[model samples]
Target: MENTATRLADIHANIARACKQARRKPEDVTLIAVSKTHEAPAIQPLIDAGQRVFGENRVQEAQGKWPALREAHPDIALHLIGQLQSNKAEEAVALFDAIHSLDRPSLLTALARAMDKAGRQVPCFVQVNIGDEAQKGGCPISELPAFLAEARAAAIPLAGLMCIPPADTEAAPFFAYLAKLAADNGVAGGLSMGMSGDYETAVMLGATHVRVGSALFGVRG
Candidate 1:
């Protein structure tokens, strides 16, 4: 069995190699270890090994795991990486440092209410359905300007954009398009693109954050 330290070291090394191949400094990319579906026991070792940031796909799962983890590791930064429902916005806003899937107006309104109630502002990424997949959740790229304007009016801090490229599509173009969209919109800070398989390409195209799960934790059971 691979020990936690060794597994973390191997994952870090792979990240370094990926950064080098993209001609990017390793520190330029933020690795968001997706911990959705994994139990606290499965994650505690990595936390002990010094990983302070994690991503979760569901509010309930995160709520379940975070209290214990937060008590144990006060410095951890939790991110919400899944499609968020309007009703769950309050819980998500209170828990996550960053919300990476702001796809609809109702969700945005709920988040705004949550933020106002909490007296805090949460950094958020407007998810762009770059592939235009009917099944995906995101504000279509064509409607971004209006969406962003509304978000701004609501005082939600729009930090950047997040996108998932279509399966079977080359990653470079998709990443480049995300970068371009962010640039064109004057929000050039956060590009949360790429995952385990295409992160190197994403880094090359200017992804500030990459969500990696299987590549770091091995195949999910």
Candidate 2:
């Protein structure tokens, strides 16, 4: 538990240093401890150490775990950071505080209807395929303008942009491109880029939220 606390502090310090270098405030950055695949016992230590925000990769997995955890700690905010199925829209809206994998118009329409039905508009980050990887789950960059317009027309609360850059490539340019795209398109939460390995670079390039897993909980087994 103590070691987990120390790890959290180290990540916080690194984020602060990065924020300072970028002329940004530490408070501007939200650290989402990615808890996907980690059991409740493994997660309790970070919560015990004052961590309150967490991200999960699947709706069913989150549904199975978070209800009991939230019963004990209501302040935790859950984020959906993985690909979301259109059929799971309402469940996702009900279960998460933020949805970071909104990549298509079909999902957008479903989420809009779900949010209206549930009366809970969870902020959504428009996932951009910064690397243009066909295997990834973001909208193609060429479609961003039209896609974002469609989201606005459907009344989805835009939470800026999110991206997972090509693996092994320097991530800074991709991060910068995301920031620029958000600014150019008037997309609004802030950038949700960066992970455990390249979060400092993400922060430096204007990420408003950083999703970190291994850096916080150690490598997932």
* Top-TM-score structure, candidate number: 2
Q: What lDDT score belongs to each candidate, Candidate 1 first? A: 0.89, 0.95
What is the overall TM-score of model 1 with all chains considered together? 0.94
Quote model 2's TM-score: 0.98
lDDT of 1: 0.89
Candidate 2 deviant stretches above 4 angstroms: none
**How far off is residue 24 in model 1, in Å?**
3.2
Task: Please list all clashing residue pairs in model 1, or write none if there are none.
Answer: none
Give per-model TM-scores: 0.94, 0.98
* Model 2 lDDT at residue 185: 94
lDDT of 2 by residue, 1-221 (tens): 34899999999999999999999999999999999999999999999999999999999999999999999999999999999999999899999999999999889999999999999989999999999998999999999999999998998999889999999999999999999999899876589999999999999999999999999988644
